[model samples]
Target: MQTSTIKLLRALVCMMLMNSLNAVADKVVTDSPVTDLSQFAYPVQDAKEAFKREQYAFVGIQLHDTLETPGVTAREVEVWSTQPVEPLNTRWQSFANIEEDRTALLRLRQYANRYNLMTLKLLKEKRRSDTMRYRY
Candidate 1:
């Protein structure tokens, strides 16, 4: 009976440790597009041109640009926590005049937010897959 009880307690402790590890493994640290972009090297004009060429570039640029504005006192971290609607809308309008690169530009612009979202999602998923790979 004593041996059985000890085994049961050991099992319980193991189970608890496993659960804790799993919880930590499942955890993900996500920041706003603003902070994420700040870590990367962004060339505003090149990004804008990439928007015209790949259109997808716009997504990255838009987030970075929105975060980089001079007097927008809001935290980039906070701004990225939510879907950046106003910036997307504004970017959409900004490219409306340039007809030649309009399609790719718009497509890229439209995808910018999604790209950032996916990047965060991938990072989260990667954290789950490889706990050591992601520092956060």
Candidate 2:
């Protein structure tokens, strides 16, 4: 009777541990945000141009797609993250053209705000410059 009781207690303890581990696994699986890579279909060339211009916002969008795509080697994301950015002034020369690159530009603008990269004053200045350029 003593041996049977000890074995039962051991089995109960093991089951409890397994249940706790399963719960932890479920929490970990559910905690992360679900991102659908299919939603990020922006052209790679556009992303490259944006990155060359030091537009971190656009680059981040591209990074999102690149990071989420299956079979994309880890080395690719490492390269993207380590890519150098040009001087801020050189990169901030022009605002995104809304008509031509609407969605991509919109995503860039959204990320720029979220990351606090571009301030309201700077955005206004960019808009003013864009207007001045067209004034002839």
Candidate 3:
């Protein structure tokens, strides 16, 4: 009887140890490394290098003396280029010229004051009804 009791106690202890081991195994946890933008196939750092450069071609015109007549002395004229050169192209090339060979003229027939200007005229190279001329 003593030997049987010892065997039974040993068996119970073994069973308890196995159940505790199973519980611990079921509760086990694991973790992976933290993910960042630099680890992907297309990393976020590559966008900083991709950029573009734009060039604007402009022209200005000033009258010899408009203050005495219409109070407006000079005016600036701007025209967009057909083909704008990019930064990757030749750096020493000249800017594109005006397509239409005409002069923009501003007429000062009347003057309100020595500083105020009036009566502006814009002449087109070709006669066109769409052309507009105004003053501020």
* Candidate 2 TM-score over all chains jointly: 0.29
Tens-digit lDDT string for candidate 3 (95-118): 321111121121111111211211
| Candidate achieving higher lDDT, 2 or 3 | 2
Candidate 3: 10-residue stretch with minimal lDDT: 106-115
Q: Candidate 1 local accuracy as lDDT?
A: 0.42
Model 3 spans > 4 angstroms off: 30-136
Q: Name the candidate that leads on TM-score.
A: 2
Q: Rank the candidates by TM-score, best first.
A: 2, 1, 3
Give a tens-digit lDDT track for model 2, residues 1-136: 9999999999999999999999976664343132222333444544445545855331232331132222223443354344533211112233322224344445444443333333223334555887899776
Q: What is the C-alpha lDDT of each candidate?
A: 0.42, 0.41, 0.27
Q: How would you encode candidate 1's per-residue C-alpha lDDT over 19-125 as one tens digit per residue? A: 99877544411212222332233344443554345333113334323432222224542443343323332344343322233443344444544444443444345
Residue 68 accuracy (lDDT) in model 1: 24
